[model samples]
Target: MGRQSPFLLQIGVFILFFILQAATMRDRIIGGREAKPHSRPYMASIQFKGKNICGGALVNRIWVMSAAHCFDNLRPESMQVVLGAHSVTAQEPSQQNFTVQASISHPNYNMETLENDIHLLKLNKAALVNDFVRKISLPKQGEDVTPRRKCIIAGWGDTTDFETHPKALMETNTEVVSRASCNSSWTGSISQHMVCATSPDNVKRGFCSGDSGAPLVCMNRAVGVVSFSSFRCANPRFPDVYTRVSEFISWMEDVMRSF
Candidate 1:
């Protein structure tokens, strides 16, 4: 029997369809460095039907960063974000979990072109900041995170295609790839608003499915959000694409102020 039931599979497929159509990426890969519990308190897990559907990061007291595709046909109230948690299954009473109050997909989001793949979530209440819960700083305006800059991607995604979702958080260090290289690898589908990263030495150490919306952080600032990948997982020729956070500072600031 599958880990997810038939009904869950249907919902998962439906949700994943939007994820695919919007981002054109495969699932996430696990087994890297372990994320520091305090480094990513805003990091969250999105659960549906007893299975993790996606990953997200807290932007503010009530806002989270995630891919728009993850919200396909799903309402804000139906989702919950488990924050301040090191592992998804950790039953620590100290974990701060919040119900979603509202979800706003980017107005210019295009499923076909995968443009504006970002989304914001409003929490019912403010998340308490503790040892395991702290907000990650957003990249400054006009900040440029170029190729070869070391960054980290973290999630509770699968270790491999045939494997089930990981029970704990995992992270890996990767370097940003150049725009020219990214364009070449993605066959010209790359955009100025998107960035790419790959593992060193062409190793299979990058984001996969179920990692959508997780942060691509560097220098204690969030630079990108995991958006898409090739079907083969972390192939050297296919760099993982992410929504460039620095380019969307205005949109993010505007949305956050409304809360």
Candidate 2:
């Protein structure tokens, strides 16, 4: 048999890789659903260079709770939080922007494993409480958010895959999936540090790319931070994973108090 050209072998490998990625992504889309719109006064958009970078909830006048992935390799000076923004384009310059003084991602965070995906941002000045700007309550220690309970999620991420960026300030509803179901779908990688949520039938209710760092809040309490979605939205076999806020409460309080 004749030897294959080196360039031909490389091209064949690239094609195979592309096909595998596509197949994985397609599986996810078939399994997921669209998330519902949410309404909360405490949610804020974290922007960088005029782009919506992540979602955060006001925890106090000077601090916001978000996902550690939001600040991964990002500098404080590059970030700004927009409060009282009903929509990105409609934001009032005066009410929308605040400078960030510092950020602290969990010391044990592992990006590859998505472990401890939590972070806190310190605002340069206290946020003024108003009808549009308020603080979200954190769940008390050991409080459990039961599975299958309805919860709210909000973000500025893309409305769909084809959309390169996120829609301006949107909210959605999804139900917490059972740990059993989530674990089965997630295989052996799901951890106590993570939680899963999705809408029934995987119809019009799931997190999309860029929704990372937003909250999966339940009953007005902070429960989870939107983390990874299976390379596709609404994958039936895989639920959207979030960093369980309850698992990191002590760490959060310690960081906030130290600042």
Best by lDDT: 1
- Candidate 2 lDDT over residue span 10-83, tens digit each: 99999998666544331011222233322466777888887676788888888988888778779999988988
* Candidate 1 residue-wise lDDT, 121-220, digit = tens: 8888998877787778898866779789998888888766655556678888888999899998788988888888888777788877448888888888
Q: Indicate which candidate wins on TM-score.
A: 1
Query: lDDT value for candidate 2?
Result: 0.74
User: RMSD for each model, in Å, please?
Assistant: 7.3, 4.4
Candidate 1 versus the native: TM-score? 0.86
lDDT of 1: 0.79
Question: Where in model 1 is the C-alpha error above 4 Å?
Answer: 1-27, 36-39
Q: After superposition, how far is residue 195 of candidate 1 from its true place, in Å?
A: 0.7
